[model samples]
Target: MRRESGRIPRRSFALLVLVLGTLTATGPLATDLYLPAFPDIARELDAPQAQIQLTLTAIMLGLSLGQLVIGPLSDAVGRRRPLLVGFALFTVASFACALVPSAPALVALRFVQGVAGASGAVIARAVVRDVFEGDEAARFFSRLMLVTGLAPLLGPVLGAQLLRFGPWQVSFVLLGAVSLVSLVVVFFALPETLPGSVRRPFRVVSLARTVWSLVRDVRFVGPALTLGLAFAMMFTYVSSFSFVSQSQFGASQQAFALMFGINTAGLMAGTQVNGFLIGRVDTSRRLAAGLCGALLAVGVLGALALGGVSGPWALVALTSVFCVMMFSVGFVLPNATTLAISSQSPAVAGTASALMGSLQFALGGGLSSLAGWTASGEASLASMAVVMGSVGLLAGGVFAVSARWAVRPAS
Candidate 1:
């Protein structure tokens, strides 16, 4: 919130970190926690499996659209009001989801829940920029990731436990309760991050200008593309994992959750590496390294999949490599985010953050959708691996070109 840009009290900083981390945690938790319940949900609602998967796409659409609206609004008005409003909406939507009887109704409610859930993620990054800049911002984000990454690791496990003991509704109830608690905490503890001096007019023309400028900026685009590609890779895995595990490998839901946890563990490891390296290396170099590493790992995984090597040990080996690629994700996301926000005017930080997030979600959503289309029989896993690897290679190529252009002397 509106604290002076000086030495923040350690306790206050810790609280701020907690709130920011919690805000960032919602989407990943929402996506991953319910994954274990997907097959069950399809059976209970008598919905086709493809239709059940579309619910995830619906949620992602809402998340992308919501940020487009909330980001600029937060810049125009203030961060606190929009965030609190969003949390309130999220709390209500989660309950609505829990109570919905039909698959279509639940899908509709999940879209609303996603819209509400988007605020924390969009605002959390803006908040980071509100207080810190450059490397400091990178460090703060890496720390936030430590907390946020835990959600993916823990969410599925928790969801598996819930589904094992209670009905699927129990998961939604848990989400609603978590939202309620976050709302109360924010109301009492979270302060305004953007001050009045930095506020911008919320006019449509002004918002359009901000978006135009952001899209045109090479510095912003480079990192944003990197982040988008990395996320796309991850989402490809998420979108196809159920089909892969069930049809291809015949793994139980519990086993699949455990595998998900193992993959998420790679994300945690990457975040730790990012925290260690952010302060030591140049951000651009760190990003390049990450992109390259992801490209290589994804390439190997794709090759393995394409070679028709389908066994338990082979699957685990390939998945493990993909999981390790997640570590590089840490190096890419925060750096790209920092570059985008730092390149923008402070008055339009909300708009900048919003566009960055919106594009990331839109790209990931598109990739996931593409993966869904490629879901033919058990070979969907191989298709997913190819898509992810291709995207990563493309991103690495962009980063390489950017570096060359940036370093070139006047001709």
Candidate 2:
């Protein structure tokens, strides 16, 4: 259904935000909700560290690959149907994940779950672009980030709390139930955002050419890469933190959860700040500033890790740096996404959004896997920090170049 042109009314605005933001939260909810169970899953399945970590990688692969297909399908058919089907798949896969008796089986199921979960994030972004543009779009995304941030903030703590009473399998069961709720909500609350008049024809060759067009559009490619790299930095932290806190600093599961919450809180705060600032500052300027902050934070983080700092104070300091990194991500991501998707026409919003999401998840998953595989028994904070810092620097560089030549959305 078509929304009114210009500003959406308050009631509709509130409802759209609630539904889209919840959909956007699915990625983190799927990934982070089970993280506290990682160690336990490893032991229970008799899997090697790398193999266990591969489960994370596998899901990321699913998410990345799934978006490549789902985005175009959404563009062709409309948003609501793909979303319903995807969530149903996620729910079923989550239940299967709970019943899996081996690491390989669990990994396979998680991959399917990731593929299913990805529809929410990709489609949610496309839906936002379907209805908004320019600074308004950035503002909407920032506000959406405020809601999406809750997933990461509470996911680990909830997982840790659940572990207090039951085996890690319960976490998967819970995930299945959450997906069921999401499925019900989407079926009831979400109307088809893509109208028939603007829908792209579904064809493989046509979709490939459309994707290739986006690939060559420096206007789209630059910020897309920036967003991807920014996500890579965040996922690196997500992948390493539990090990880093527990193995390196002797933090218990609960303590690690607290630290995770603190970092996500920083991310949420940044998104809120962006929501306020998007009208006052240009999106490019805001992006540049956020990248600068990230560069500085990651630099300090690397130095501290390499210095071999230890103790509770050291953990506190490290967490503080990570918080800064997350805050920077909050600023960079929404703005970068605005820059990327706003350049595309509505006809290809799904394809454009899909391409961007695919790149982000691919980079994030790849980096997380590398971090897991390279680290020894103890956490390799120095190496992870260096990797994160280097990516932060590269993302900043990409944005600087892109902002100079990129097309701006109409105000």
Candidate 3:
């Protein structure tokens, strides 16, 4: 699963990037595209606010657990099969979600959708590592994020527009239709990036050993955890933003969509900058700088939020904090993933990628749920902001400490 000899052919290269980028976007589509519908869902299903938030938690948990199984299965078998199977399952789950009668049923279906969606997200990264290594992999991931980031930028706006013409169910129907398209593309265009010669057996003992090995490696573990916590901070906002914008700031749905898009634009810009800085500046230095920036951004956000500010100034300050936090994440994630994956055996790229993805969402899901609970009814951003600030500072500390004592991957 090391870098393939010579460059991929131009047509094949374009095809890979296009398909993988779309595939990488499924998770965002699943989460972000339906965000504006939360209030509608709560009303229609007769569910409490906490329960609606828990639905989001369910999906995150499903995504976290799904990668743990799918990654290893891809390692045992091949990338294409799992992708096709997962897409099919995702399509069905999404369609079912639109038809579910109760909040609990919808939550259950969303969990299945997340599990099915995990295939694309997990495999896209595995395929990248399958084809490239080291800084090249980092650059490719940043480029991939450039494509993937667009989903978040446009998803909420898309959802809001859908809600204007129809019910919230329309969003799920749209998810199904888009996934059907992804299925066709994967089936026709994606190749088995992991060839038979290098594929590993899917043994429980072996999987455990590989995971444990990654955990024991300080270089991999530190950046991996840093990536997770950074994402958790971002997800804190993602999970809480609807309430924050609407309840705390008194924004209309359209205004909220516009604001969400603006902040996501910051994230998109950061990915492009990350791609540029990949080889020019060392990835480690860039990662450390990103974490430091995130720490500062979240700290300021927490301070302003707790200081009891109000009006447009408060809204502007919050959006600024979010943009900076997202910018930092865009820089940190790809570099951390590149470093962690580079440390593992190519034979176990799928397993390693799976562990990283699983830990990220698992941590993210827990943190998101915590934010949701703390912000319930009251819709207080201050508590969540403080938690995010703490996480940002901790992630920075971890990166600094790991760089001093951690083992570097083999060149």
Top candidate on lDDT is: 2
Question: Candidates' TM-scores?
Answer: 0.94, 0.96, 0.95
Residue 81, model 1, lDDT:
89
Model 1 lDDT tens row, 35-84: 88888888888987777777787788788889999999999888888889
List where candidate 3 sits over 4 angstroms from the true fold.
1-11, 375-378, 407-411
Q: Residues 1-411, candidate 3, lDDT per residue (tens digit)?
A: 243622344446666778998998988888988888888888999998778877777888888899999999999998999999999999999989888889889889888887888898888888887788788788888888888888999999999999999999999899999999999999887777787888999999998998888898897898888888888888888888887788877877877788889889888888789889877999998888788878888878878877887887777778888888888888888898898888876678888888889888888888766665563454468867866877777778888888877744541
Please list the residue runs of candidate 2 whose C-alpha ends up more than 4 Å from where it truly belongs after superposition.
1-10, 373-379, 407-411
| Pairs in clash, predicted candidate 1 | 1-192, 1-193, 2-192, 270-327
Better of 1 and 3 by TM-score: 3
What lDDT score belongs to each candidate, Candidate 1 first? 0.78, 0.86, 0.84
lDDT of 2 by residue, 172-194 (tens): 89888988888999998888777
lDDT of 1 at 164: 83
Candidate 3, position 400, lDDT: 80
